[model samples]
Target: MSCVQTIQDYGLRSLGFGERLLPREGFTLCEQFTLIGSGIIWNVYFGALALAAGFLLATVLAVAKQSHNRWLRKPAEWFIFIFRGSPLFIQFFFAYFLFLSLKGASSFFNPFTSAWLGALIVLFLNTAAYTGEIFYGALRSIPKGDIEAADAYGLSGWTRFRRIIWPTMLRLAWPAYTNEAIFLFHATTLVYFSGFPAWQQKGDALYYASYFADKTFNPFVPYPIVAFYFILVTLGIIAIFGAVNKRLNQHLPQEARRKLRIRPQVIR
Candidate 1:
């Protein structure tokens, strides 16, 4: 097939539109690009939803961990420790089985059988813990003067946090959070590899790349295509986070603005 025909067939294949069955015998470069690109939709979905839902919970966790109240602090600490101490790949497996066991226990829990909700739950909690730790460190590193100044203004409790502490914490944590975002996006590729079924070959980029490699016996072509798609999206994510980081530090003087840097994290 020509490039245009391949694009027309597999462009939206991830959504189960055209080309019900993936190309088998005659895999072309066009097919590889189109199918892999289609699969990227799932990556974007997982990362975007996980990051968005995790942000507020992560902030709450950071605050709880920092609280003087043992009831709040200890639980928060344990939650963070449990999630961050273990591999996310392991979390997905455990969560999938746990959800299956509980599926019939309640009607509200029915959605957990599917990857759309089940895998998302795991990713949300996982990213929340990592982000919480980052925020906790940033919270502790906030200048003592900032709190004292809030006190001088008769600001306390939520007033102080809303107007003073939270903003500064976010500013300090923004860089690390940016890296965390990229890492989390890369981590989305593990969803299909885990217990979660694609439900119809509707897997992510890596899944499609592997499929093509298996069919064509040319990992060189499909894998590079996956890398190309990931790199493009990763750079786009970095650019978006960079803009947010700049706004977070906007109150500081030009010399004090923290530059965003990409430091790839290795889980092992």
Candidate 2:
């Protein structure tokens, strides 16, 4: 079949459009590309939503963690430690099961057994913890001179934080936060493979890739397609975060501001 025809058949298949049944046998390159590409929608959706929501929560957690009061600081500290210390894979399993058990409690909890809500919750918390740590470190490292200047100018409490501490925290935390964003995007793939079942064969990019691999016993074709899509996504993320990072540091001399770097440390 022509490439166009193959895409027409399998494209958006994850949404229950186009072909109702996936290719049962003799899966072609075009089929793999189209199907996996269709699956990329789910990945993008999960990553975008989780990351956007996590950013605000992370800021709150970071500030709370740095609070002088033990009541505020201790909980935030333990939260960051627990989530950051555990493997994401294990967290996925544990979260899925925990949600599963909660399903019987209410109708609202039932959605948590599915990837949409289940995976999103995990990704959200995981990103929050990582980002919180980055922000917390940045908070501590904010030059004392900056705070002194803010105080001297009669800035205090919320005014001081909004004008001085917040911007500095963002500037210092951005590079590491960019790394966390990339890792969170990659981590979205683990959702379907974890305890949550992909209802109606609706799965993310890695899910469809793994499906093709199992069907044809050919890992080469499908996995590479998934990887290529993820590379594009990773680049897109870098471009976006780079723009934000630039804006955050625009006040500083070029040499004083550090460029955003992608360091691949394990999240947990």
Candidate 3:
């Protein structure tokens, strides 16, 4: 088939919207690119939803961890510790089985056994833990003078937090948090490879790349395509985060601003 025909057939195969059957024989370069690109849809879905949800939880976690009350602090501390201390792969593995067991208890839990929900849950909690620590450090790093300034202005409680503490925490943590966001997207590839099974051959970019590699017995081509797609993803992430970083630092002069430095994590 022509490349255009191939695109039409497999462009959305990963979403189960296009051709149901994967290309069987004599796979061409167009087919590989098209199918793999389609699979990237899932990666974006998992990363975007997980990152957005994780941000809110991370904020709460950071506040809880900073609380003097042990009741609030201890659970937050342990939650972050458990998720961060263990490898994410193990989390996905155990989460699948845990959900599977819960499936017997209620029909509502049925969706949790699938990658769509189960894997997303794992990603959400994992990123929340990592980001919570980042925000906690930022909270601790807030200048005592800033707190005093807020107090002098009669700012206290939620007023202080909303006007001073929260924005300052975000500004300080953003550079590191940008790195976390990038890493989280990269980590989404682990979803299908982990215990969560891709139903009906619908999978992520890595899943399709692996399929082509196994079928063609040539790892070089499809694997590099996966990398290319992710590189584009990384670039898109950098662009978006960089804009946010700029806005966060807009109050300061350009030279005094803390520019975003993406330090990709080699080990997590």
Candidate 4:
């Protein structure tokens, strides 16, 4: 088949569109690209939704961790420590098992066993803890003089936090937050590999890549294709986050603004 025909046949294959069975034999370059590209929709879905939900939760976590009251602070501290100290792989396994046990208890909990809900829950909490630490550090690093300035202006409690403290914390944390965002996207590939089963062969980019590899005994082709798609997606993330980071740092002098860098470390 022509390249155009192959693309047309498999472009939306992940969504149960176009080609139904995938290229069984004679897997062309066009087939690999189209199928893997189609699989990317899952990655984007997991990453984007998890990031959006995690941001709000992280903000609350950061605030709670910084609270003077022990009731609020201790739980937040323990949460951050627990999530951040453990491996995400283990988290995925434990979460899947936990959900499985819950499903055994009742039909209502069965939905938690599925990839869509289970993976999202794990990713959300993981990202929240990581981003919470970043925001907490930024909150602590907020210049002491800023608080005094807020006090001088009679900006107290919610008003002070809303106007001055929160903005500065986000500004300070934006660079690290961008790094967290990138890692979270990469982490989505782990979902299918974990305990969550990819129902109906519907899976992410890495999932389909692994499937092809096992079938043809050729890791070289499929894995590289998966990596290429991830690289493109990662670059797209950097672009979007870079724009937001720029806006966050816009008020500062050019030299004072933090430059975003990618340093993948063990946060999950």
List per-prediction Cα lDDT, in the order shown.
0.91, 0.90, 0.95, 0.90
Candidate 3 regions exceeding 4 Å error are none
With a 3 Å backbone cut-off (N, CA, C), the pairs that clash in candidate 1 are none
Pairs with backbone N, CA or C atoms under 3 Å apart (clashes), candidate 3: none
Name the candidate that leads on lDDT: 3
Strongest candidate by TM-score: 3
Candidate 2 lands at a TM-score of 0.96
- Ranking of all predicted structures according to lDDT, beginning with the best and ending with the worst: 3, 1, 4, 2
Which has the higher lDDT value, candidate number 1 or candidate number 3? 3
Model 1 scores a TM of 0.96
Ranking by TM-score: 3, 1, 2, 4
**TM-score of every model versus the real structure:** 0.96, 0.96, 0.98, 0.95
Instruction: Estimate, for each residue in 1-268, the C-alpha lDDT of model 2 and write its tens digit.
Output: 8899989888888877887888898787888888899999998988999899999999999999999999999999999999999988999999998988788787789888888888899989989998999999999999999999999999999999999999999999999999998888888888888888988788889989999899888898888899899899999999999999999999999799879888765435
Taking all chains together, the TM-score of candidate 3 against the true structure is 0.98
Q: What lDDT does model 4 reach?
A: 0.90
Give all candidate RMSDs, comma-separated: 1.3, 1.3, 0.8, 1.5
Residue-level error in angstroms, candidate 4, position 65: 0.9
- By summed lDDT, which 10 consecutive residues of candidate 4 come out lowest? 259-268
Q: Roughly what TM-score does model 4 have, to 2 decimal places?
A: 0.95
Model 4 segments beyond 4 Å from truth? 265-268
lDDT of 4 by residue, 233-257 (tens): 9899889989988998898899988
